[model samples]
Target chain A: MTAKLAERPAGADLVRSGIRAQAANSSFAFVVRAAAVSVFVILVLIVVTMTREAWPAFWHSGLGFVTGTDWSPSADLYGALPFVYGTMVSSLMALVLALPVSIGIALFINEYAPRRLRAPGVYLVDLLAAIPSVVYGLWGVLVLGPFLLPYVQKVADTIGTWPVFSAVFGGPVGLKSMFLAALILTIMIVPIITSITREVFDTVPADQKAAAVALGATRWEMVRGAVFPHSRNGMVAAVLLGLGRAMGETIAVALVIGSTAQITTRIFAPADSMAAVIANTFGESSGVNRAALIGLGVVLFAMTIVVNMAGQFVARRSGRKGAGT
Target chain B: MTVPAALHVPPTEAPPTALATEGLGVYYGDWLAVDDITLQVPRHHITAFIGPSGCGKSTLLRCFNRMNDLIAGARVVGRVTYGDVDLYDDRIDPVQVRRRIGMVFQRPNPFPKSVYDNVAYGLRVHAMTEDLDDRVEDALRRAALWDDVKGALKKSALALSGGQQQRLCIARTIAVEPDIVLMDEPCSALDPIATGRIEDLMQELRRDYTILIVTHNMQQAARASDYAAFLTTEVDGDGDRRRGKLVEFAATNELFTHPQDPRTENYITGRFG
Candidate 1:
């Protein structure tokens, strides 16, 4: 067939070669497109299932289901605000704690590490990101949580004396609290941010850095003046992507977050993130409760999409501005 | 049989001969890149390093500033001194050494910050504070970039053209007021027009600052250098490596007219690289 194609008639040869090239390209494209469509189907299935289950709740209780504060299902009030608050709080806390650490790790790997060690260090950090979120939750619950709560409580009480730390602890100690969840979340996001920030830093032109160093700029000065500026937009996007992961985290957040739907005021208190609430209640819920849980998923999905879009938009604008400069 | 071209300098501004090197050698991970380079770039003159590709010209240029130290496993043997101070001394910080000897790269590499910030970077790093805005402006003027960039002080450095970026780098380097400026093929990546601008800029800069440039463009070396060093490499008998030594050192016109070494004669005449 190959020989025939090679010696094929002129018009037929063009068609054969074109077809062969198209076939090769299309095979790759077909796989990629199939994977994309598979993801689309999965997302659609998830949304449809969630809405099917959550619709009954909206019909039965309306917007009040989201606004209601009473979450004791046994006595029968299931407001989701408290859980939503808990999820938002813990995720934000994780972001706040993880962002700077991630940037530090990334910079350390990119510019600060001794020449021989940089690549290996980055790989080790990325390995941490690959660890399952559940393992993090388990470790947080068994090892880290007990080690942490006292310090957290003490700091809370100390700073709690000040207005900023005023809220009393509301979440569970390990398996049911905002502090544990956030800590686990922080541990998880660190790897993601580190890997991405390092990769972005690598994208900075070596000549650009050389230019700064040539000017009598110190190593720190080169990073502060050149590398950091070039990678800032990318770093921001990386952090936001990590934040989205933190926000949507289910197994880890659920494992540690105390499952409750009540909004409360303490950093160390027990609480529920969106996924945690859904995971905890979905199995037992029928009709309205199931629908409510699915509603929770929809809200989470929308939030994830919003976070991604905003991050991408900021990244694009920053890249343009950097290019313009 | 005959001496290689001795690098020449304008007799008026030649640095004191006492502080220069003898037999400078460089190694990269056990591979000798630059060999048997002996030349003096006296103070206050433009000395250009000219050679074929992979002739260790860049390595030789970087050795003066110890910029090669930044590369891992890059080892240097031989003496580089400033007055009585040995540059490779344990007491000497590469940072401090670099402050005295500045560099400009092949491609224009400006920090991504505003043009003002890019100029200010070196000053702030060295803790040299005396009317920073004035210093920034002075450096820019010295590099001939101030006129174009003055209005856009706050604009990002990345916004500049390739030529402008290279000039910005030169301005940033001089902000520290270094004693020597090293350039490694500074115009290799530029268009002829940009290359011409850099040559003119080099001539103007040589008035107050000493410069060492490595260039493959023999014409550029001929045009801009007050002093020129020619370097090359060879595989010795039994697989030992050796560098091509200086062919002759004389004023640009004299060397081109009467190259003493056969290699130099061939190179200048464009018979071989």
Candidate 2:
């Protein structure tokens, strides 16, 4: 036995080198950590660049940069209140208009569609997302404006009679107005909210659904009890994402918003958003004017971030509540 | 549907049969999962379906409550009767059938909700909201889970241990006061100690509800059940296809000691499945 063992060739060790193996594992971990940290670094870099470029406007105007409404580049007067009002009203209008319609479409696709029609229905809804914003802008200018002008005029004429309605809906109602811009934005954001909410509803566990039906819940009741409760946080997140998209939209709003620096309560009146103003004026402006445009970009970025953070906070708290004690 | 009228009020107390299947066969598309299963489940008694895996015992149990209807391609042939009402009749709403006949699944599927909410779910769904807290407490008491979870009623049901969750599911089912309860392998996911607790709970529940349990554990069938239905799979000529069929159903003692069918005898003797 000893002679045979000696004649046999020595086998390689089965165990790997501990240091080498650990080094390989930690090398992959370090790559992941680097990728994770880069997001924060990139955000900080953008903020620094914006703040540095915007310093001249901040020093010249101080708080007037936000509260002032004048915008004459020749005189170096720059106020962002009109643009801020425009962004807030248009985005809020889009959200209010799109949320119910999106939810209805999502529920119809997931629950009420025939088995054979479900896939194609979902595909059609998702196809809405593929339509370029430029195309929507072109449609808003060429087709939507002509189509909705009479209705806008009629509403402005009729509601303009009442004291309260006149206060809110007064002024010239035109083809290119805040209402048209918001309507276009609503069209663009609906598919986004719809698809995300539909996917969230689909993720509701089959067992919980069964539990609800087993308790004698009607079809609608099952949706209320099991499907809605399970996906409430996800639906909120989807709406916030849609709001973000609407707030940052530039080309579409600029095309139809009749870019003007006047804050008016009348949604039918022409107004300017931060993005629309920047996109329209960034080419011709120079010196403090260019710095002021960058400052508006900073404000828009901050607003979007604050809204997104609030959305995430709400989603997280509701998630914890759903998880129970 | 109006309140109280919408409820399934038994015309008479202690009906001889809670659920009876006549020539019942369940099929998933073309594949017959369970065939020609005709059985009468005695009211307020524990009837256990015992067999090896893939024997369609759970399939047959689902048929009683029309839970099989939830499966996309699944279809049931023949009639399942509850009292004078034919459960499979076209006019009968499955939602009402399910409310009258509740079910407990193999796994503990407590909703991501508080323990109190879990028990109150059926009550609220059925519009039985008048004495909700009292009803929830009574259900927890009946399921033998009240003592352990009383202090944590507001706690998430998911925070409970496996056995406690199963008992919570039972409480949820019984809170609606269904006339019959179907349990599909209720104790299979639990440890021996938890299994023992559930078996004891079953004994207490039998006094108020008709219990039909599908169990793979023959010992459990022998120990806890008043009646035993033995089932086994029979392979077709190609040997690639198998279907479940009932072999013998008798009193638990008789079925265990002197099984009529040779296959059942072999199974009981641990000779073959």
Candidate 3:
């Protein structure tokens, strides 16, 4: 049939080649579509399996799982409030501690760093990201906790007088506490946020930067007028990415967070995160307790999804303004 | 209509030179891009630099406002003077030099901000905030963009058509009320009709501001300038190093009709660049 098509007139040659091309294209597309669909299938399967395993705990606990703090397996009491509190507070604490420093480092690497230092600065930031989270946990336990104790105590002494600060920083500052976990999380997430922010700042149009300078804007003002506004969406997305990482982190947080089932106003107090509690106790847990741990994973997944949706919303809003020369 | 008095300076009594360079050369790291040349830009007149690609016309234009200082490894030798002040003096700030001499780039680069904010950016930067709305209005009117964009002042500057965006850039440049406006191929990215509008705007602008423009289009240099400078690239025998050298500096009509330099005549008559 191939030899006959080649022997045929030019019209048949065109039709034959067209059919052959179409066949190749459809086969390629079919392979690609299958690969793409597998990801969705795996995701759906995970969700279904988790939902099935978690349903019993959900039915037994009702709203109590969210608001209750007790986690005594012997008493058959399972509440998730302390873990939720730890996760939320530690993540927020990390964000608060890391946001300004990350932005400053990003700006320095992009705009203000001396020419010779820029490359090394970026490399050092990447090096920070490459360090294993377990190493960070070890450093938090051995080096950082000892090194920072005196300063943390000083801060606790100075600002502990204020009502708001007292509530957050009051109580015994310990080696393993919500504050320590948040500090460790800051170390882990800063590089992620800074690298993304630097890349976004780099994407600001060169002509726009020149425009601001040509209009007599000072360096800081030029960054404000051009770089920051242009990169705002990407910056938000970067911060949210860091937030997601901080929320899902397991081993480092488990080691530092002290894993307790009490909710307290003091951030210096020991607390438990959902991932930490699951990792620490899941091996020994059975029956409804294991199911409740799986349910906690579901909640963490939902929170990350909400964060990602907010990031997408911000990205789309700024995307409209991205249509520039 | 009044800027805060402390931040405003009355234009100096018509100095013979708005900006002038003596023995000026620019280098990017090891490469010498433009060689020593002296030229004077008369106040309130249009001086156009015409050259082919890689001829360093834009480099020379950037010298007026110290804009070349922004580029890494860029070095300017010799002196550039804005009236009596040497622009490269250690006491002089490039930011201040930029304020006195504004620039418009080849592409339309409005901030990702509202049209009003784009025009107001320079004002707010220099702290010339009093009656800022009137200043923005005056600038837009002067650039002949007010009517087209007045209704959409709050709209993002990036939302405008290319021509409108370019005009908005012009308004932003002029809003600072600089003494000299350096345009580096401002109309290169525009259609002929848009180019024509900019040419008309340039003529109107020249009545008040000293305008120095670098353009690749010979006709644009001839049609829109009072004086023209022609530059061409000189390659070494090894072809390793190329530098842009000025061939002719004369009144537009004289340079075009009469051949002071054979190279200028060839370039003007389409024989070579």
Candidate 4:
């Protein structure tokens, strides 16, 4: 009927206007699809690049790259043990220190914080995340380093007899160590964890809270029994995402870490991580040294992919199960 | 409908007992939702608070347990006395008040736990018992859900049907052993079968607890509540939306048979909201 009417002279304008409206909607849909594709492509490209570099360490070095501990690039002896230990220890430190603070901050924003304060609290947390990696490094060097030194030195001197402390607390506070890197990483990742956790916590339905409240559960009880349990998987994912951030950080770790290739966790002792090693050595070294560091980069790159893939795999599987249920 | 010729005298004059509101008012920021409602939710019976949408029936229920305080701007005024204690007293805690006066919301929001866990949630919240298993079993039995859900006590509460879920919520509330249970449109989203089950459950449970239910269904109000408070709101003489008067409160049989107020008649007859 529309085709028959459009054939007539009188129907030409209406058909043209209808076509224009349809075209507008069609264009809007096309833009949305294009944006989605771009995001997908960017993610795929990052994965491909990381894997392309990573495949060498996995293919050539194989189990040795993962299992071996010594890392000496000076005379062509390269083992990933210390960097792996440093990465694990630092990330673990970051997570343990940041987890409670991040969760607390998220809860405050989601529940206890006043209505007027909620949005601003969120903004402040985001601003923490927005600060550049170099600024964090500079801030640690100029401010946090001196502040942490005295207490760290005292603790190291006090606990030097303990096995763990004996290994880590040998140096004074100014020297780079796993603890300092971990502390810096903790401060860096708190905002990221809090922001993501807060978002996920916010998505928990109001009705659920109200229901728990009606059941005579206190605010803390409601969070513990309902909100936390419901959003636990997402919260874990948020923490893992923060761990990923802590592992990959370069300038901040480089600035405070004393840049020694050792697995020592002493807060006062100097030590280095994979990212810190690569950052400090990249510009100065050449030939096999750079390739070894590149090889370490290959290792670091591989480790993060596995970590993030594990994180996102858990996130997606849980998301699918949650959505299905 | 007029006050019956035989039952001509007022009803609330029995005594100043049960629930009494003295010059009560409520505010949220600059907005006043409840305008000085002085009422006595009768003891040993169900009281229905029936009003149009946003007439503050639900708001009034929240006030009893200080649930309104959860809202950032909400404030309570005047006095609400339960037995001898003033609920709004400066030293009083909302948690204590809420524990005594449990509430069930419109939607059935069971905690995403096993049926047993959902029932035991309140007991654990109140820290009333260390042995939660027996307590959970007893509460479910009281809510008339023990038989149906008994076999699969380990099943998630979400697996229950909408009606069963609501009853599970009731079981959850009752587990804490509150004196008064306030239900905010508890059956609005339920099917007739579910609604009937809840209505019957209320009748069986009312011997030990006072219940206040806010309902949209007039028939439900007539069926469930022994005493009814018909609330209404209108653009008042001050040109602001003033909460309508309490109109009247009476025995269920008398209120429905011969309602004294024209507004009640119109509302009951479906002539207008």
Per-residue error (Å), model 4, residue B247: 0.9
Docking class of 2: medium
Model 4 pairs in collision: A69-A81, A168-A266, A176-A258, A176-A270
Q: Judge candidate 4 at residue B17 and give its lDDT.
A: 55
Global Cα lDDT for candidate 4: 0.80
Residues B48-120, model 4: lDDT tens digits:
8887777788888888888898888888888999999899999998888888888999999887778887887
**Alpha-carbon deviation at A304 in model 3, angstroms:** 1.7
2 against 4, candidate with superior DockQ: 2
Leading candidate by TM-score: 3
Which of the predicted structures, 1 or 4, would earn the higher DockQ when compared with the native?
A: 1
Report the C-alpha lDDT of model 3 over B47-153, residue by residue, as the tens digit. Answer: 88997798899999998899999899999998998878889888999998899899999999999889999999999999999999999999999999999988999
Against the hidden reference, what TM-scores do the models get? 0.89, 0.88, 0.92, 0.89
Best by DockQ: 1
lDDT at B87, model 1? 85
List the TM values for chain B, per candidate: 0.91, 0.93, 0.93, 0.91
Provide the clashing-pair count of each candidate structure: 28, 0, 0, 4
Q: List the residue pairs that clash in candidate 2.
A: none
In model 1, which regions exceed 4 Å deviation? A1-12, A15-35, A65-68, A74-76, A156-159, A162-164, A168-176, A312-325, B1-9, B12-19, B240-244
How much lDDT does candidate 1 score?
0.78
Sorted into a CAPRI-style docking class, model 4 comes out as medium
